[model samples]
Target: MDLKKVERVYTSYAGVYDQIFGKVFHEGRESAIRNLNVQPNERVLEVGVGTGLALPMYPRHCRIVGIDLSEGMLAKAKERSEALRLTHVELQRMDAGAMNFPDDTFDTVVAAYVVTAVPDYRKVVNEMIRVCRPGGRIVMLNHFRNGNKLIAAVEKVISPLTKHLGWRTDLSLSTVLEGTTLHVARKQQVNPLRFWALVECVNAKNGYVVLNGAAASYANGNGAAGYAHGNAGGHYASEHSV
Candidate 1:
């Protein structure tokens, strides 16, 4: 990925980014964080922590270290952290695919709406799991290939243009999580218009099992609601009734 180009675009638009994508972006973000069930004093690391949108949602007692590839984004994130008076949060410019932290350094790792932005998402995911403790969580809030034919068509049609605009419409969350140790804990469709979603997962074995599913009802309350049926293709979607 062209870090210079990414930094330039984000820096130039930082002032208006919130106003432009605020509605769709904020909803998915809030839902993702809420479903995370983060506890106090947890050491958390946020990859691609652009503008520090999740900083305010974190517990005050938790320690947070945010990293982004774009210096422009990190600058805005620093401003947000200061504005929120989050003394425990730190912002730095770093690549998501290559983190500087030690292995198992963080109790929890978060990546919100960032999978699509990074050039090498698989490497980034592996890096996230590598830094997280054995029993810790990895939460993701992102937009992916919705099973709807109409939306899929639209995504395919505009994907080329969207890619130029910093959007990777081709990467699906379902495929992204495949064969990874991060288990899906909870997931909900944020909004169809934006194709956004809130998904939570935990690291386990060679592949991640859905931790919030019927097998582990204690992980999250959603499991007790009974397993909701969906298509067999592995893609699931839930309209934002929240």
Candidate 2:
């Protein structure tokens, strides 16, 4: 993928992106964050932050660093920070595929509506996992290609044109999940059309296993296992919910 072209596409529309995508994907974004259950002192990194639409929603107690390749969008995000008094949120202009952070730097890392737009989705995902500490939550809120044959065919036809607009319409769930250690904690269909996917995965490290649909986290040093289960109201039990 041409990085310059991708940068240009997002930069050109930084001013109008919120109007175009804000409400359309708001439900998924909200659900992802709620499920994340970010704590007061957690360090969170938001890749492909773009215009900082979710900045205002983040907990004020936690520290949030949002990065995007588009300088224009980062500029808007900065303005949003000041305008909305989001003191805890920081915005930067950087490529998500090649972030310059140390290993295990963040407690939780999130990517909203970005996988399909990145030049290399796998690289960005691995980077997100590498920077996140063990037992961290990796959340993604985006529109995946429909599983239905006719709808998928229509999405594929439109993706070529849509990619130029800074996103794709035909990104598949399996395509992104392949070769990743992240496991789905829950999968929900959001939005009025029910086309968007709210996928939450746990960034489980060494000695991880899922039993009976719940993630049971067991590390070498601990005899106590962390069991997480899905709660009907949306949020999962933190650490030992199962």
Candidate 2's C-alpha runs over 4 A off are: 213-242
lDDT by candidate, in order shown: 0.70, 0.77
| Candidate 2 residue-wise lDDT at 33 | 79
List, residue by residue over 1-242, the lDDT tens digit for candidate 2. 56798899889988888998788878878877776666566788999888888888887978899999989889999999999998888788888888899987877788988898887888889899888766566778888999999999999999999877777888798888888877677788988789888887766654444344334433211223332334232323234323
Worst 10 residues of 2 by lDDT: 218-227
- Cα lDDT tens digits, model 1, 6-122, are 667666767777778766588777776666555556677988888787789877866889998777768888888888799999888888888899887876788887888777789
Q: What are the per-model numbers of colliding residue pairs? A: 0, 0
For every model shown, what is its TM-score relative to the native structure?
0.81, 0.86
Candidate 1 deviant stretches above 4 angstroms:
191-194, 205-242
